[model samples]
Target chain A: MSTYSVSDTTAPAAPRAALTFSNLSGRYGVGLAASLVWLAFGLSCLYWPDLGDWSRTGSLGIGAIVIAAFILFGTFSADYLGSAGQALRKRAPWLLAFGAFVTLWEVATAKFAWLPLPFFPPPQSILEVYTDDLPKLLDSVFASIKLQLGGYIIGATVGFITGVSIGWSQKIGYWVHPVLRFIGPLPATAWLPIAFFTFPSSWSASTFLIALATGFPVTVLTWSGVASVSSAYYDVARTLGAKPSFLVLKVAIPAALPHVFVGLFMGLGSSFAVLVVAEMIGVKAGLGWYLQWAQGWAAYANMYAALIVMSLLCSGAITLLFRTRDRLLVWQKGVVKW
Target chain B: MVVQSAAEAIIYPAVGAELDIDGVSHAFDIDGATLPVLDNVNLSIAPGEFVALLGPSGCGKSTLLRLVAGLEKPRTGSLREDEVRITGPHPSRVVVFQDPTLFPWRSVWDNVALGLEAQGILKTQRHRVDAVIELVGLSSFRNAYPHQLSGGMAQRVALARALVNDPKILVLDEPLGKLDSLTRIAMQAELVALWQRKGFTTLLVTHDVEEALVLANRVIVLSDRPARIKADIAVARPYPRHRGDPYLADLRKQILGLLGLEATW
Candidate 1:
């Protein structure tokens, strides 16, 4: 409701300054320098011969050149690109650091034969796995995502219901609290041998392990969240003609959302660990299974490629969860900063 | 002074239910010990009357208000509204507590709509929520969250939330106790104006003697813990009562004396 008026006079001057060459030099000089470094490395990959006979050298050079072109375009036309260009310009230092790291990695492994060949494959060798084995890697990625999502949704729903029941009813708490305390602390991986024997398939057993990993934190946090709601909140609702169902659904749940999100975050992290361990030990096909297969064949480049994919997958899942939390808890905008 | 129009009269009804508290007593169990709060209290409030209860600090004033609001049943005796025994909380009687206690996740409009939403009539009576928000002078802040509001503004939203239910009995348990003196004075006048316009049976509990005199037609003073009514005095003053009036100042002195404090000023 509070209106803040910006001076219109200063607005025109900002875009005019952005158009000036001097301003562009100051703002984007570092990014341009970083892009040029990448371009040089890309050019060297095409010209220089390697001691290790790395395939996909041309593909790596092309990828680097494309990235360099993006950065160059982003830096020069930052005003035109709007917020995205500004973001890329800001990441100039990180881009330069990454370029330096890749160059060193390439020099150590393929060029000089240092740091052991099988363990530390050059950047181009990892790129070769992507080009040659794209279909299998994509299948593994899909398997991992499906397995993780199925377990997470099941675990989160059951945990939320159990938590609310425990917090609300004395009889349910009495019955379940002891069991939860006894079984919740043990690692889900500890049950792998039994889970594999009991379940119909390796996939089902892995899912059970993932669910166990995700359920414990969610149950505990949600129980605490529900139990700790202010009595005053209930009083207000009751006096306003709210029934028991209304109190639980409308009053208790919305109030405890911040804590539930915290639980979900913890559960997601633990689920990732369990998912990988389950896949490696029991499941037929997933990123973890792919990693194990790569290691068995001594395809270290494939292993490195899978690791990169795994990190991206995990971070992407976390980002999706955070977006949901942000939308649901919009009223808590100023109270917490992510 | 707010003059109620004929159409507004039909909408608001200007008819409050009579309240009867018959030998009501209340106590809380603290650490396995009985803490008696209200002692043998009996009072009858007429419809459309504004009554203020003044008492010593922690003298079961809020406890009595809670009982009236039906948030808690008395240990003994009965409270009735229009001859119906009060057993539990209902929308017909609503209380505004010392703290606003607005749901932080709800916007001002959503918070005000809570009563209707709970009763499952919000879909049909949506205009009532808007009307109450306008009544509290918070229409401009309808979409704003609780955190965006100032202390006084949040309290107004609380009032609007309670008003949306169209309660016959409005319980006020030191609702302005937390406001600064200037806001408190301004709100006291607003409270009086609202009572005049709505004509609900108002039971206000306050620690401020002048606030009681300024807002209520009748003032009931209570004793310390295990509170007993000491005096019930009528304030025969017109609307826009001045704080500097000699009669009000004399009454403030008498009430302070009854509370075991000297009105030195």
Candidate 2:
């Protein structure tokens, strides 16, 4: 590795970088510009109804604008990488188009007051409603997320350790799998009545529901991950002089990571949904409780705000999870793969 | 017990001498019936010898390797290292499987270090990983993930993993079978180079007769299912032998002949 040869190697990197960035910019720029135009068009339709309405004769311009914004967002995000070799990337454009169509319908009902009633609230009103409860919305958001995260960690920790132990041992898998399968599919809600009678505290009842619901998914997923580890891995481990404990921890567990994470993500989602119901059932202060309270007071605006907070928190969690998966699995991304 | 006794009956052929395997046989319960997988197979590999077990699919060639590695116990006969019966996998015996079973989560160094780590080698001895990776010509990929490596690289990583423990014997089960033709050939040559450098007694099981002929000092051809050693052809070719060598082709046909496209029952 002489300096001259090193320089020779380094020189080629510039061209590679140039080519990659040029492709990236060329792809994303078009989508960005298209999105800007959508925003403009949407704004005009709202302000001056005569000019920008594409989907319906009379629709609020704001609804159209939101639709366009989301369309552009999806299109750009989906296309940035280029050539995923899968159908999802190909179908993304259509998905964005459909979203746009839905937005147009929403606008038409509210803006022009077409088919007026409780059927379709104006998109503008929904936005205002969301904004009105921003303070309380933040409160409920924190409250629900706090409970959800607590339950998820406890349930996932117990479930994963148990599941892996069970899966790695045939005798254990045989003993536990049948019992778990019978109990797992029983809905989280079904136990709510029993929990109400047994647990003295409403918070305990809510936490228990969250844990039970989330644990089933996490346990099932962990078992699947552990079971699906390749036979060759075991052979390699065996030949390498690994002890049984070494084999389980080193080979089986790491190989089962992606599957275990899938369970964690699913469990998180279910527990969140369950928490909302539990919060509304008896106790107060959580997002579900506040949502019910707002609805009872007929504060539609505040209710919408709480809903927005819920969406943001859930999507935020999903983004964090996907980012973690992507980072850990960098080798399986575009250039290098499974 | 039969297998162990059979191996015990034979000398390891002498110190630093060939491993003598005699009358090894095995069967598995397939659908509640005892299905014979190998029967009365005997072969010997001189110390530092490269012997490829050539056979068709389901011929129990892999089963034979697993038995040697102590991952499987044969029903009759035995496997031994230095005249001692091999009862379980130990750091002294390492195996490379067909799929290049490098742990996806570990880097190349960690994978290579796995064998030593299992033997309770101190963390200070971890530096030995670099030497093995270099022997495999995988120095550049030492930090790479299994998922990031090409098929050939993965197999090389697997070999490095096996060799880093400084095993007395190396067993490879179709280790290069997953690579494409060109990579397979390239890997075959690399394998021979590594064997010569490390000087570990090697036993490779493969479907490719030509690969066996090119690399092995002794090429053992097995009969179809319930496999037996049908032919034990001695390849007198030198190390780094070219595929174009004429004598190598002669040995290839002899191995193919033992496979018997027989009209004979």
Candidate 3:
């Protein structure tokens, strides 16, 4: 049995040794192919005459060529280029797919006019929005960040405190649980009409809606986290002469943190939906407002640009939250994989 | 063997406290039905004595240990340590539970430092934490988290955590119950050495009759649930006693018989 088991383990090693050289080349070959695809895309953008007027076609072509050059360089020197080159090499297949997709989009929209004119502007037209409408886009980005941060901070703090209170004390739970049950399930957008009427400004109303959206999940999850802490933990702390405050702050809070992060992730997702909806409905500025304005003016290129920016911002925020969760819950690393 | 040198590095003053369980009875409410656990149990433990409670599983020996630890209140009677009533858990009396119950988030050092930290004396008395961890021979694993430890190592950390408090009485609820036999034997020797060195009134609950005979100076056998004290037999053996000694084997048989099991071996 031992001999058989030893052979079973060594079986995979034989193939691994034989395939090492080819595997390395195969991995880098994907990056090489991806760069060639991007090179073809850039050349097509430069040579293909557009059926419609596209201003930043040259800039788009240059950008694609620059990307192709980077990928080609990275594929050849991945070993020396450290982590960045490794990341580029890893993403080579996706980049190749993206290059193909953009080439098709440009051909259909600009060169051939197969899709439509006003609706599906070429990729260069979206790039034109970035180049031409820089100031307004920058303003919208800042406005959205400020509003979202303010709402998120307020919502997270209040939710955490309320959750701890409800979880700790029966009296608080008795009073708040019913209210939470009543209000928590309703979408924050449903409060749009009343919030606008109640608050002084559309900005404040929008902030309130975002806060409401973020708070419910945070409260519920945090409460559950605190409530579900093993009674044995409390006993251990108490026997060690830990006071009520110490038990809550040190024991309960740290134990409940993983759940709190889950809540934060959920809250952040819901807040994005609320933020965009609120911006579209009433707010004067934000990516959502930019998108609405672009649509109204029949500037589909600008709308696409705003959408790209919105997705990047939302995904970036989630990544940052995950990073923080990873750091705080390092002890829980292998126990629960994100 | 590592514990011998570590034990010499620290010496505890004989601060063992007398425990008095005056007609203590306890019960639990399960599905609105009152279930009796311990029935009018009374025992007096002298200062610095190692006593082990031997019983069948679910015989309320653990419940009695909890009462001594001041983790739970008795339904009908009072428990006292050195003539003072044990109303709630305090640093003077600490417990090592069956599962080792070390906070999963804290490292071994931090877990051991808990009692002092809870008492707000960790900053000044950090050496106590280091000493206890060393005593348990887990100094190398001071920075290691609970999950990273094997069952024995984690149990050692739990012991260190309790010992850091310098408790007047140590309540162990089947502390070595889950360990494998080899590790259990080694830890049993280690526990005896620790108990002798520290001189803390130790109350250990276990179903292992031979274990009770080998470790405790006195073995108290209890009957099944609403556990009544059946017999309290004193093992007048000297330290570094042999496990293969016929005296211990005979006592083990007697205790097992008391627990309603024939010593077939």
Return the TM-score for each candidate structure.
Answer: 0.95, 0.76, 0.94
Q: Write the per-residue lDDT of candidate 2 for residues B1-265, one digit (tens) a residue.
A: 0012222222221222346687899999978999999999888778888888988888898888888888888898987777888788776778888888777777778888888776677487766776667666767667777776888888888877886777778888888888999988887877886676557888998888778888889888888889988888889978888888989877766666677743321
Span of ten consecutive residues with least summed lDDT in model 2 chain B: B1-10
Q: Give TM-score values for chain A, per-prediction.
A: 0.92, 0.67, 0.91
Tens-digit lDDT string for candidate 1 (A256-291): 888888889999999999999898988889999999
Scoring each candidate complex against the real one, what DockQ results?
0.58, 0.32, 0.47
TM-score of chain B taken alone, every candidate: 0.95, 0.89, 0.96
Give the residue spans of candidate 3 off by over 4 A. A1-27, A335-338, B2-11, B263-265
CA deviation > 4 Å runs, candidate 2: A1-135, A334-338, B1-18, B120-122, B242-253, B261-265
How do the residues B1-265 of candidate 3 rate in per-residue lDDT, one tens digit apiece? 5464644656577679999999999999999999999999999999999999988899888889888888899999999999999999998899999999989888888899998999999999888888887788877788877877999999999998998888899999999999999999999999998888789999999988778888999999899998999999999999888889999988988877887787465
Judging by DockQ against the true structure, name the best candidate.
1
> lDDT tens string, model 3, A1-338?
01111233332211222325675568567888889889888888999887878888998999999999998888877766767866887888999899999988888888888997889889999999999999999999999999999899888888998888898889999999999999999999999999998999999998888888889999998999999999999989998899999999989898998889889999999999999998998999999999999989989999999999999999999988988887777677463444
Q: Which candidate model has the greater TM-score, 1 or 2?
A: 1
What's the candidate order when arranged by decreasing DockQ? 1, 3, 2
Using lDDT as the yardstick, the better of models 2 and 3 is: 3
> Comparing 1 and 3 by DockQ, which wins?
1
Tens digits of per-residue lDDT for model 2 on A77-126? 55343344223435545554554554565456544555543434444455
Model 2 DockQ, alpha carbons vs. true complex: 0.32
lDDT of 1 by residue, B1-265 (tens): 1222322522776788899999999999999999999999999999988999999889999999888888899999999999999999999899998899999888999999999999999999998887778778777788888888889999989998998898999999899999998888888888888888788999999998989999888999999999999999999999989999999999999888998887465
lDDT of 2 at B262: 34
- Residue A305, candidate 1: Cα error in Å is 0.8
